[model samples]
Target chain A: MAKLDASGFLIDLDGTVFRGQELIDGAAEAIHTLQSLGKSVVFLSNRGNLSRAMCRKKLLGAGIRTDERSIVLSSSVTASFLKKHYPLSKVWVLGEKGLTDELALAGVAMAQKPQAADWLVISLHETVTYEDLNLAFKAASSGARIIATNRDRSFPNEGGHAMDVAGMIGAIEASAGAKTELVIGKPSWLMAEAACKALGLPPGECAIIGDSLESDIAMGRLYGMKSVLVLTGSAKLGEPRLYEPDIVLGSIKDLTELAKEGILL
Target chain B: MAKLDASGFLIDLDGTVFRGQELIDGAAEAIHTLQSLGKSVVFLSNRGNLSRAMCRKKLLGAGIRTDERSIVLSSSVTASFLKKHYPLSKVWVLGEKGLTDELALAGVAMAQKPQAADWLVISLHETVTYEDLNLAFKAASSGARIIATNRDRSFPNEGGHAMDVAGMIGAIEASAGAKTELVIGKPSWLMAEAACKALGLPPGECAIIGDSLESDIAMGRLYGMKSVLVLTGSAKLGEPRLYEPDIVLGSIKDLTELAKEGILL
Candidate 1:
């Protein structure tokens, strides 16, 4: 079999670079080496809670220098999708500031009342109130199309796995008697498009590297990109695999050696 | 096939007797007449928000004279289930006062922290806060057994269909990455058993009356009771049926005529 040759990489954030404020081992050095070789590397996250600027700051805090332009988030992808497809629609949001801020930055119309909504966007809000859930339900049942940020059920947190947007989506869709019309993150074509757009590379020329098999590896397989599974996060060795990756690494730290081997050329 | 000769009746509330604040026509007369015939009539409701006392008050306002003994609610059923099975288990709740009140009334242990809980009970809470959801997520993820009050996605309200316990259940299950282990209400055998126990009659001698096909009618079919569907609720004639009832009535008002024809006798 031929070895993978990629000009750019779409990297996951949580479970890839850092988890719960703790940076992964060799993460900064690997990214530095990849950048030193002039290989395009774009960090991708399905988190609607972190805007690109916020993610950039966090990466910088971890000694990884990446501009906001190099970070692509689910919020950003959703914003762009809404801006292009639902430009005139009044969007109601059940989300945190990062998602709402991105939508506003993209010139999407925001609706304060459920009755005024043409679209209802869902994301995770750990502090979401019952009244807020009702509003989302009302907007959705009243004919607003639902757009979800991601399908992640939970993510590893300091305590354990914290509920993600999938919970919110599950609740709203059940109440609204409808399913989400679109999703803007991993495994969705929309997010794949957004990441490739940020890297300015074709799908075949890029590799998606992350710790999740169902999400990261699935996204790569669905979009014709080489997939690299790392073990720094959620996935473990010898676990039952639902999605297989083209390559496996102990962690993102191993990328430096792969770069030295001309894989990043 | 032999005709139904029920000695007792299991009646639903919301859609069967009333909607929002408006009492359905003849609901009071129907119950009064059934009681006059010396036949047992137990009001069965999947609502975890209402206790038997609260339901009695509401029915009183509707001109129906029924004691708490004649009412069987999901909360009451859940409390009984917990008291019998998990008597020593500390329970945490993502629910309203009705559910907690019933649990407390039944002497079910209550825990305030996720770590301290052995069971997590879920019910509808219109005013539940986000922190509460996280607590539920925490408890469920930490291996607390999930017990849901009902699976109702929505119910008829003043404006339209309102989101119900299903939303809460959906959110928690997705977040916790587990399905609910038990449901204490309609379509669950537990509720059927509760209703029949309240009436002090065998299932074959009782008829279940309500407007929902999936819940009420399905419950009757699952248990050994006769089922009656009424038109004064969310269901409509000619709709594709997922469950088939034994009989159909225009409304509860028609019960009086059915009573006159020896059906209630």
Candidate 2:
């Protein structure tokens, strides 16, 4: 089966491997199994507000046994895309500390003034202010290119789903009469390209497993990866399907059952 | 002749009446002439961030004698609409002092906490904060009905167009995945009704003169009132027409010219 013969796998972090502080059943064991079988694995996280380092630590705490290098964060992908494509441009960022920290660590040049920015990177900021929005508006009106990390309205937060970065983008675009030039996050080619490069595999040689039909499963469908859906997170059964997966299981624990059926090495 | 035959006039404030501390040409003399001719004149302002009292005082300073009773502000229309449709509901307002002050003056019950709000009134707030948006999100998720004053992305400011209430609405809608229930502003039936009542005139007996075809002229078309386009503001010559007007003029001062043509008493 195409689903069983992948050399590399891009796995979603949140909801798939763990939920908040608790690990999903068989997630760690499945990763260990895949690694032992000589399959390359990369944890792909869609949350831009968290750096790869933080996600790695969180995964490690949950017994996922993954390093930072093996984790591909949306923010890190954004940083790399900027560094490679717009190396000479100065960016004005609107994000939380984690996203800014990742960009800083990646050595991206930041603009001191919004009006002087060559690019305005819009991301989630919990304490976003009118001043921040006004500055971004100024940057947009002054001809700065806009790029957003993710357009998801909300994400699962400790106290329920919190508003995401799209709010920040909506404000700037509304004021300046401009549209975002790029979006580097799940279900987009930019994100898919990043995950493939991290695992050193072509799209046809990789399988993706996650709990979200919109983001994770859609990514698999768009990038031509073998997709598997698990019932441990935000996805519900038969919820207005946008993308169909090759397999659906009770949990990652059932993945080991596939090998018993001679579906894998 | 339909433009000149109106017994009442709904005049747009900013680009048509005045622009940033300066009166448009013939605005003062035209209003005085219209008043002398026994025509009911109401200055209809779309800017919700300013109270009726503030607009009246500004008009009086520009040698255009007008009372707060004759000025219809969008915020006041929203306040009236809420008080009429949902008298017992507790409203949580996201606006500047002028809007809240007007709502308070109108005796609308205000909700102290966003979560406790029964209706969330979204308007323009220059110093909007993350806490405000989060609270709005909380209120929306708690099942509060949402109503916006205006959805104009921006309005003409001293430096340029300043962002309007749409940004705040965009944020709350994005988070809650809900659409605004009502928008009480220009081109909306609520605003038209309010303006018509203020002038004690029927839709056919009233004419709206303004710089924006999308807003002022559209209101006339929707409500069956005479619509006059002025070259003095946001509108331009042949700017991809949405609403066609009965006549176009250089300024409101040219209103008397219609009388010279024997079109009115």
Candidate 3:
């Protein structure tokens, strides 16, 4: 594929900038170099369990330069999309209080009963119970459209790893036998569209850098964006070559090297 | 269908006893009434998230006479069936600890990684994560046999309802566009077979009673067991009449009344 004249960066977390609690090698320095070149960048993560503030705090704590607006968690994007597409709809939430709060802030009504809900939003909720899940299913089964944040399986937790919202969404899909209306995270073109809209740029004027082939590269392919696969996170050592990323490097260390050589700019 | 010499009682919970938090009028009394006839009765629920212990707790709390052993949750039946069929195999549990513990107690090994597993058992798990769901899709996509618990779209909780395991399984089916291996709970005939095996009785010697036409009456029809539709829970006053059940009653109370009137033995 021919390269487009992209001037902005849409970066993935987890494997691209950090893995678990540790920062990926040269991630902070490479991001700084990208900024010095006057490129607009947004840190996007499919982890919707945490709010944008929490995500920004985590990134800053890991020496990443980011602000609340510069960070877009999957939940935030989904909430924004719902607000734009279906304002005032009663939603049955299968997500955490953050999602519920976001929907509320977006002026959407939360329905107490599934049968009365106008729509369903499936997200990560730590306190989600069987009752909540059933309500979501019932609402969706009764013709309410479903909107999901991401399809990520699991993410790094303080302890090993925890099941992310995708699992919860999966359970609901199995029961309801319905597909979600939209997915506003990696592997879905909607994520790229959201990022482009947020940055005031077109899809062709952006690059997505991440560690997972299925998420980052697949998303790039879907949205016509350049994909840079980094090796410092979730991917196997040979996964970059196996998956055929446009640019396969050891880590952000190579990105900095490319910047120093003026090849990236 | 001719009435057979079936004598045992297999009752369904959720739709049978209550809807949401309100107990169907006379549902509790119906259980007591069935016991008064010295009949062997077991409450079978398709909700997979709750363990039999939890089911016992929920039912007893709802004023229903239920014990852990007499209540067969979908997870238990699924795990038990796997154990009986595959004595030595590693199972990738896409559910909660209850399912994991049950499979462990049944002498089945747990496969943490998807590639190491041969079979995928999809059930209701409160702790289900995106990782678990991804593994299920990947495993099933790679030709692993998929065994789901039930196809119930929604499950009743103390408050109202939650998504049943079938909902999540539906998502996997959508992604992979494949059918599941088996569903072992009500309406599938597998539940009837399990009941028959446990009681050492043939299908002709059993009678199925519940509040739903799809799960209860369908199983009865599939297994050639006499089905009695009770309208005290999920169904309306005349919903069961639409399915052509052998008998339709207002509740188990009606069953007891018929027995008292010497109309039923």
Candidate 4:
């Protein structure tokens, strides 16, 4: 492949930059190199369990210097979408602290009872109860608009895999007999738009580098941005090219090679 | 439309005999009347949250005289199925105390880790956590056989509807990329066989009377039993007759009227 140039970098966190608590080799240096080259970089994450500040702290702990403002989370995108579309609406949330914090910061009123809510926001949580499911079902049956952060069923954890938000979303959909009206995460235009806004650049000038073809690469292609797939994550090289990425590299370390070859400007 | 005759009675508990704490009108009297006529009756329940003892206690509290031997619960059916099919298997349970207690009684070895389980038994509980979901997903991905007590999405409670085992099942199926291998509850032949064994009668000689056509009537039809639908619960008069019941009544109180009309043989 010839040298490819980009003005803004949209990077994934869990698989590309690190896995669990350990940092991927050359990830921090690659981000620093891009920054030295005067490229605007935003860390994009589909995880809704942690707040942007917590995400930034984790990135910093792994030797990457990024602020909360430079972290684009699906929770933030969802909050922004709710604020713009359903202003001052009573909302019921089924997520962790990260998602709830974002909505509160957006000044959206939280509904104590599910039936009282005009909207329902669903995400992943570590302690979901049957009562929560009943509440969500009741709210949805009463005509509450349903929205989800993402639909990734399982994510790689310290163990083989852990249940993600998609599992919870599927359960709610099955019980409520309603589908999600909006999904503000990777593979959706909403996440891409949010990242572009953070970078202060147009979609044409931005490139997204991540591991999963279904989410990261699909999102990039949906918004007409360069998509780079790294192999240090969920996807493998020999897998079917369902969502053909713009470029496939062995790891994020190849970003340094792309820089050395004058591919990344 | 004339009073129907049957040998044994297969009755549902929640909707037909009682609704929550209040017993349905004439339900106890109808059962007593059937007993007085020397007819065998078995109470069938899809609820897995309570053990047979607890179920019997609840029935007795509601002015009915039924022993544990005459009650057939989904949990007991599941336990029996597991003991017969996956003998001495290391089972992991995701259910309430009733299901776990039944499995323990069956002497099936319990697995603490998901990967260590040879079988996964899923049921409903009020306090399911995300960690439980992750373990179930991991076990299922590692080839653990999945079984459920029932697949009812919701049950009618005092507050409209409460989420049931189907929601949890759907969530695990979505995350694990696998479906349940066996569901030993309503609409399954397993429950019918258990009920028939309890009554010492064949399916053809028994009649099932309940409110929901989807469950009680469907099971009866599946096993060639006489299906009766009562309109005191979920189903209405003019809805789509997906599974037509042999007879329909306004409530279970009409069973006495059927006896008065010389239908009880």
Candidate 5:
């Protein structure tokens, strides 16, 4: 089969380019190679702990030059999607400062407390407490729409791995007897759409590169993009057979070779 | 407050005396302290992966001395409990060899996989597969009585951990759109009654000591047993306030002192 032409690149962060501030050896070079070939690139991350500005700072700090327009974070996408779908909804957030700020920027009103909420957005919160859990349970059980940011149970941390929003949401869902109606992050179609919109290209005209099968490859498959599994991060040397992406490479260093191969017809 | 009368100790293993192979630091000393006070102590674990002999061997190896008579694995209790409640019932189990053997010993016939099963018993299995998940889901959705050994997501491993039967059952329950009717492990009144019956003591007369507030302390609270929280395992320092156990101690070293003070009334 001939390689499909793609207009842009949609990349994932944690398991793709870098894991907790350590950039994959050749990932940045791949993006530069794509840019030099006249292709747009946008990075998407499900981590809601940091703002988009902070993400750009970190990426650039890791030697990968990035600007505000070159990224779309899950927090931003989720907020925008929720605003578009449920305009002026009274939303309750079980998340951090980034999530709250993003929702406000999207023109969504934050519910004062659980009892005053019409919808519930479950996300990762560093200051998660029992009172927050109790309030979330109340809101969810009272029939609030439960929207999760992602289903990733854990993520890389500076010191040690930590339970992400998925773990917290799992406990809340169990207690409230409600399932998340929508997930708006990596592995979700919404995050891909956000990236495509940023690049002014259709999802079908993009290539997704990441190191994890369940998230990056799965997202690429869902969005009709060419998926490249890289071994620099979460994808181990012998684990690519499980997802079966369109391309398997050692690192982003091979992007020039892929471009030269005329696969992007 | 006056010292409370205590009959014997009923312990839960998973997050209590030990997590996986290593015993809680003071768990062995706690048992020795209880034994020196002439209080009978029995080890109980909800893990259905091993037989009674295996459980005994493992506990002994971990410094918590136990004989077959001094231990109660959930599989054996489940088999006996099912036989007592539903004589001639065809039981379907998604578990290991130990579970099947225990049911056989109870004179209960194993039902036809999932198609003809009357009840579903979920237990920990090292060999959990997609086929097993499908079978469990089918049986649960087909109006079978759903019962689980416990509600723990992951079992403690030597270093990290592995997803346990509880997580597997949670997935099945999610797909079936129904929660299990009963959890037969510690903190549940069913298994607590069985332990009380074996000790030939009234529920109010028995006492439980373990490291988990949700399971062990909750069991004691549910069955009217004096609950003692020991910090040799899963329960951290501030966990007791959430469950409110009757007695809170850092370790089992205080058992002899309490007994001498006529706490075992």
Candidate 6:
């Protein structure tokens, strides 16, 4: 196969760059090399708990120097999507401050109760209460449109794994007998489109590098971009490939070498 | 078709006898008349939040006189099932005080942490926290057996509908990538067996009456009992019957007339 000469790069955060608070070995150097080569790099994350500024700070702490503008989050994408579609709708949120803050900044009116809202936004929050879930259920049952940031079942954490928004979403859907209208995250074309717009490049010239095939690679494939699977996160070495990516690497550290060999020129 | 000629009655509470706090028309009279006819009346409920004593009290409040001994609850069945099968197991509970009280009375040791438990028991608890769900997820991912009290997605309440234990169970299952090992409630053979034991009759002579075809009618069909679907609750008039029951009625109020016709003799 010919070498993959990609000018734009979209990368996943949690499993690709680091796991929990520890940085994956050689990830930062690979990013630095990519930047030195003039590749447009955008760090993407499905985690909606942290703002773009907070995410940039965390990236800096891990020796990968990136600014807020280079970071794209699901929360931002969701807010933008809602603003474009339902600009004047009242939204009820079951998420953290980052998500609500983004929605608020987008000028979306927040509903105090589910019944008062036109849309219900669900995300992962460690402190989510039963009443919050019940409210979401009631609202959805009452015909409120439900939207989710992502559908990740679990994510890498300091402790083995932590429940992700998918679990909560499943619960709400089961109780309400309704499915979410939109999920503005990896594997969804909306998120891929947003990232592509941010990079100022067409999907054909960009490559998505991440650990999860179900999200990162799947999103890239759906958007007609080069999908690169890294082994630093969710996908295992021998697991069946549900969605075939353009390339596979043992870790993000190999990206520089692959570039040197003209494999990722 | 001949009459039902059922000698023992296994009735559902929430939808059949009462809707929220108000008694369903003719429900109390039907139960009283059944008792007057010397029929064995056992009230079966999938609600595990309340103890048998508490459930009996609620039945009394609805003008139905029933003793604690005549009530078979999912919590009590779960407690008995665990005691009989896993006598020396340490259990971690994600339920209300009623479930915990029942497990404690059955002499099951309660684990403080998920890691310390041999089994994880999940049910509906309005106050369940993310921490509780994470603990259950961790335990189940670590090979702990996951057992649920019931799997009702939503139950009838003062409001349109309230989220039931199914939501919690789905969340845990999605996070843990494991299905429940046992569900000791409606639609499950375990609960039907327990109810039959309480009525001191075989499944052949017992009739299961309730508002939900998914649970009550399904459970009866599973145990070779006469399934009677009542239209006062979850099941609607034209909904698809996944499992065909023996009989269908507009409401439990017609049970007396059916008895007079020897349909439920």
Best by lDDT: 1
lDDT of 6 by residue, B70-135 (tens): 898899899999999899999988789998988888788887778778888989888988877887
Once model 6 is optimally superposed onto the true structure by TM-score, how far is the C-alpha of residue B183 displaced, in angstroms? 3.5
**CA displacement after TM-score superposition, residue B232 of candidate 1 (Å):** 3.1
Which of candidates 1 and 3 reaches a greater lDDT? 1
TM-score of each: 0.83, 0.79, 0.73, 0.92, 0.54, 0.81
Q: What's the residue-level lDDT of A220 in candidate 1?
A: 96
State the C-alpha lDDT per candidate. Answer: 0.87, 0.84, 0.73, 0.86, 0.74, 0.85
Ranked by lDDT from best down, the candidates are 1, 4, 6, 2, 5, 3
lDDT of 3 by residue, B125-220 (tens): 655454556667666665667887776666656545566666667646655455788987777666777766655568887888888887888888
Task: Give a tens-digit lDDT track for model 1, residues B1-265.
Answer: 2255789999999889988778988899988888888888899999998778888899999898888888889999999999998889899999988888889999999987887899999999888887788788889888999998888888777666678998998888876787888988888898998888889999999999999998899999989799999988878999998888988899988889887776654
Writing each residue's lDDT as its tens digit, candidate 2 over A20-138 gives 77788888888888888889999997788788888888888877777777888778888888888888889888777778877888888998887789998888888898877777787
DockQ, prediction 3: 0.32
lDDT of 5 by residue, A1-265 (tens): 3475788888878767886768777777877888888888898888775568778888888777878777888888888888998897899888888888788888988888676788898787756654465567667767898887776655566733444676557645665667888888777777887888889998788888887888888888887888988777667876435557887878767776777888755
Which scores better on TM-score, 1 or 5? 1
Q: Point out the higher-scoring one by DockQ: 2 or 4.
A: 4
Indicate the worst ten consecutive residues by lDDT in candidate 6 chain A: A151-160
Q: Work out candidate 4's RMSD over C-alphas.
A: 2.5
Q: What is the TM-score of chain A alone in each candidate?
A: 0.95, 0.92, 0.86, 0.95, 0.89, 0.94
**Order of all candidates by TM-score, from best down to worst?**
4, 1, 6, 2, 3, 5
Candidates 3 and 4: which is better by lDDT?
Answer: 4
lDDT of 1 by residue, A1-265 (tens): 2365788989998898887799999999999987888789999989887788788889999999988888889999899898998778899999989888899899999987897899999998878888789889999888999988888888777777777888898888876777888877888888888889989999999999999998899999999999999999889999998888988899999888877776655
Cα misplacement distance, residue A32 of candidate 6 (Å): 4.8
lDDT of 5 by residue, B71-188 (tens): 7777778888888888977877878898887788878777876757778888776555444655665676666788776666555565244455655565456555557777777777
Judged by DockQ cut-offs, the docking class of candidate 6 is medium
Two-way lDDT contest, 5 vs 6, winner = 6
